[model samples]
Target chain A: MNAALSWLESLLVLAGLLSPLMLPMLYFLLYRPKRRDGLASPIDSLDARAARPSFFQRWHCGLKVACLLATCFLFISPRGLAVCLADVAIALLATALSRPSWRRVLARLAAMSGFLTMLLLMLPFSGAVQAGEPTYSLAFLPDSLPLRLSGLGAATLIILKATAVALLMEPMLSTATLADTLHGFRQLGVPASLTQMLLLCHRYIFVFQHEAARMWRGMRLRGFVAGANAASLFAIGNFLGMLFVRSFERTQRVYEAMLCRGFTGEMPRAAAPPMTARDALKALFWLALAVSPLVTEMYFADFMRFLGE
Target chain B: MHISDGVLPISVSVAAYVAAGAGVAVSLRFLRPEDLPKIAVVTSAFFVASLISVPMGPTSVHLLLPGIVGILLGPAAFLSIAVGLILQCFLFQFGGITALGVNALMMGVPALVCAGLFRWLQNGDRRRAMCSGALVGGLGTALAACFLALFLATAGENFFAAAKLALVAHAPVVILEAVVTAAMTGFLFRVKPELLCLPPRSKWRGKGDCSL
Candidate 1:
C-alpha cells in the first residue's frame, strides 16, 4: 500500500486541524450566554446547573463513555472511523442537550487546534521509506506521491482520533458542575483524599490568581517592568517567593481550621446509592451501541473484501 | 509542550500513561499526609505560574517551572505536575485527557531528574546553589522538550520535522525557565530557607530539611 495520504485525506486533515477556528463563531451563533438580567454566566444554567444525576445514572453514563473510548482506541478502519464520527455526533448532541455555554466548546476546540496543526504539519512530511523507494523530500516537484499520500493518511488518522475523543469530553466534562463530577469520581472509587486535594487545589487556583495579580499590581506600582534581564528576573523571583510564602501561611491556617473541625487526611464522603437493574440495562445499551461498530467491523471484514471484489 | 490527543499511536500513548501512572503512584506514596494542603497550595502556584507569560524578544512564553516544583516539592513533584495538568485540561483545555499522561510524563520526569540533580549539585554552597538552580531550570525545560520530541516522533519517521520544530521552539523557554528558576531558588534560599528543602516525606527519608 502506498504510505502517503490521498489529496482527499490531506484536505480532511487540514480541515480537522483548522475547523476549530470557526467554533467560537459557531458557538456564539448557536448558543448565547446572556439573559435579560445582564449577568455573565460562568456556565450554562440549564443542564449544567440543574438537578444532579443519581449515582446510578452517572455510572451508567460513565460506562457508556468507557466503551466509547475503548472503541475509539480499538478500531482504525473506515467503519471504525464512522463509529468515531457517530460517537462524536452523539457527544455533540449531548452537549447541545445540556445547553452548555458556547464558550466551553469554543475553548475546547481552540485548545486542541494547536496540537492538531502540529500533527497535520508534521505527520504528512515524515513518511517512512521502504527499500529502493525514493526518499520523500520537501521540494517544489515531489518524487513520491505514495509517501505524501500516506503522510496525509497518518495526519488524518491523528486528527480524526483526536477530534472524536476531544468532542466526547465536551459532554462528559461540561454537562455537570465540577463538584458533581468529583463526587461521581469519588463514587467510582477514586481516593477521597486525592479528590479533596483536587478540589482544594482547583478552588485555590482562583484565589491565588487574584493574590498574584494584586502582587503584580503592587510590583508595577513600585515601577517594576518585566524584561529579559537579571533585575527583572530577580524581581519576578521575589514576587513568586512572596506568593509562595503567603500561600504557605494560608495553608497553615486552613489546615489548623480543618484540624479543629476534626479533619482527617481524607474528607468524609457520603456513600453512593446502590445501582438498580435499570441502570445496568442503560449502561448495557450504550455499551452495545458504542461497541457495535467494532463488532460489525471485525465480523464483516471478510464480507467487505467480498463486496469490494 | 502539551502533546494533545490523537497524535501518538495508542501504543505510545498507553506506554506514556503507564509510565506516568507509575510516577504518580510513587509521588503519592512519598507524599506526607500532613502536607496535602501544602501540596495543593504549591500545585495552585504552579498552575497560576503557567498562565503568566513574560515577554522575550518579540514573542512571549509562559512559565512552566517544572524545575521549581521538583526542587521544592521533591518526590511529590510528579503528583503536583499531574494535578496541575488535570486542572489545565479541565479549565483551559491546554491538553486533552488522552494526552494527559504523556504531558505529565514529559513535564514530570524532567522535574524529578532536575530536582535530584539540583539537590546533589547545590550541596549547601551558595555559589553552587545559584549555578545549579540555573542549570536545573534550563535542563528541566530542555529535557521536557526532548521528551516532547520523543513522543511526537513515536508517530513514525513522518513527525521528525514536527519534533525538531517543537524542540527548537522551546529553546528560548529553556533559557527563560533557567533564569527564572535560578532567581526564584536563590530568593527562596535567602528568605524562608525551609521552603527550599525537599518537602517533608512520609516514608523513611533523608532528614536534609535545610539542605539548600
Candidate 2:
C-alpha cells in the first residue's frame, strides 16, 4: 500500500510538472479558434493598415526597411539573457506600436513553433556538457541523456532572439503596401528586375492559389483523399502537373495581354515621395533603440553578468 | 526547414547574403527581357504547389519541389526561388528576413545543381527522363538537407545534434519528393514534351519539343 501511494504521488508530481508544456497542445486541440477568412489575405490587412496615420506608416518605406532590418540584424547574436530580454521587450513595443492584429502575431509565432519545439526537445538532452556544467540524469534514463543547464539557457536565448526578430518583421514590412515596400527595396539598390518579378509574383500568387483551391475542391468532390501511399503521391503529382500546365497556358495569355498594354520589360515606376528630416530622425531613433541592448551588454558588463551565474 | 532569424551566427548570415546576391546576379545575366513576366507567373504556380501537403504516417509535409522548380525554370531557377522565398517571408513568415539569404542559398543552390543534373541526364525517352527526374529530385532534397545541417552546425557546437536530427528528418521528404517529381516529369513528358525539352523561354516560341 505504501509503494502504491508513493508511485501515485510521484505520477501526480510528474503530471504537474508536465502540465504547462502540454497547455499549448491542449489549447490547439480543444479550444481551437474558428478560422477568420478575412485574415486570409495578408495584403488586404496591409492595405487597410496602410491608410492609418501611424508613426511607422508615415516613415519612408525605404528608410524603414533599412533601419528596421539593421536593428533586426543587431538582435541576432545577443551575448546575454539580459540582452535577449531587452530585445524581446523592444520587439513587443514595436509590435504594439505597429498595431498588427494579435491574430497575425500569434499566427507567425505558431508557424515557427515546430522548429522551436524541436530545438527545445533536443538541445537540453544532447548538448555538449562542459567540465563543470550542471546536468540532471533521471534514474531510469541512460546517463548519456543528461539534461544540461547550459543547453536550456542556450535554447532560451535563441527562442527569445528569434521571437524578437519575428515580431519586428510586422512593423518593418507591413506598415506599407507590399508594392511600396518592394519599391523601397528597389530604392535601396535591389535590382529593378527582381523587384518587378516580386511584384508580378505577388499579384499572381493569389490567383494561382484560388485556382489550386478550386482544383482541390474538384478532386475532393470526386472522392480523392490524400494518404501516405504511392497512389496518393501519384495523384498529387498529376495534380501538380495539371496546375503547371494551366499556369503555363495562363502565363502566355497574361504576357500577351501585358504586351498589348505595352509592358516593355519594365514596370513603370511611380514617383516616390521625397524623404523628410523627420524620417531621418525616426531612423536614428530606431537605430539607437536597436543598439541599446548591445550597449548595455558591452559597456555595463558587470550588471549583465547573470548569464554566467 | 527555413532557418529562422537569430538561429544563424550573424557572420554566417551576412556571408550567405553576399553569396546569394552573386548567384542572383549570375542568374539575371542569363535572363531575357520577355522571360521576366513568364517566370513570375510560373513562380506563383510553384509557390502555390508548394503549399499542398502530403500525408506521411502521422504527420504531413509540404512539397519543397526545388528539383521540379529547377527542372522547369533552368538557369532562372535561382531568381525564381529567391522571389518565392521573399513573398513567403513577408506573407507567411516561413523564413525570417535576416535569414532570407541563407534560406535562399539553402534551396536555390540545390535547384541550380539539380537543373544542371536533370539536363545532363535526361534523354528523349520518357522513361529515362522520368528516372533522371527522380534522381535529381532526391538529390536536390538531400543536398538541401545537407546545406541546412551545415548552416545549423555553423551556429555552435550545441547545434550539432539538432543539425543531425534535421538531416534524419528530411530522409522521408527526400523519398516523397523523388516519387512525386518522377510522376510529374512523366506526366509532363507525355502531355507537354516541350516544357521538358528546354527552359521556359524557348518553350514560349513553341520550339524545342523532344519529339516524343
Clashes of 1: 7
lDDT per residue for candidate 2 within B40-115, as digits (tens), equals 9889899888877788898888889999988988878898899899888877778888899999999999998998
Q: Score candidate 2 by lDDT.
A: 0.81
Q: Over the stretch B1-212, how does candidate 1's per-residue lDDT look in tens digits?
A: 68777777777777877888777767666667777788998899877767776767865668788888888877788888988998888666677777788899999999989878876775565566668888988999999999998988777788888899999999988888888888888777777667766334412135445321
Per-prediction DockQ, in order?
A: 0.48, 0.59
Give Cα distance to truth, residue A197, candidate 2, Å: 1.1
Give the candidate number with the greatest TM-score. Answer: 2
* Pairs of residues at least 3 apart in sequence or in different chains that clash in candidate 1: A3-A150, A4-A146, A4-A149, A4-A150, A5-A149, A5-A150, A126-B158
lDDT of each: 0.69, 0.81
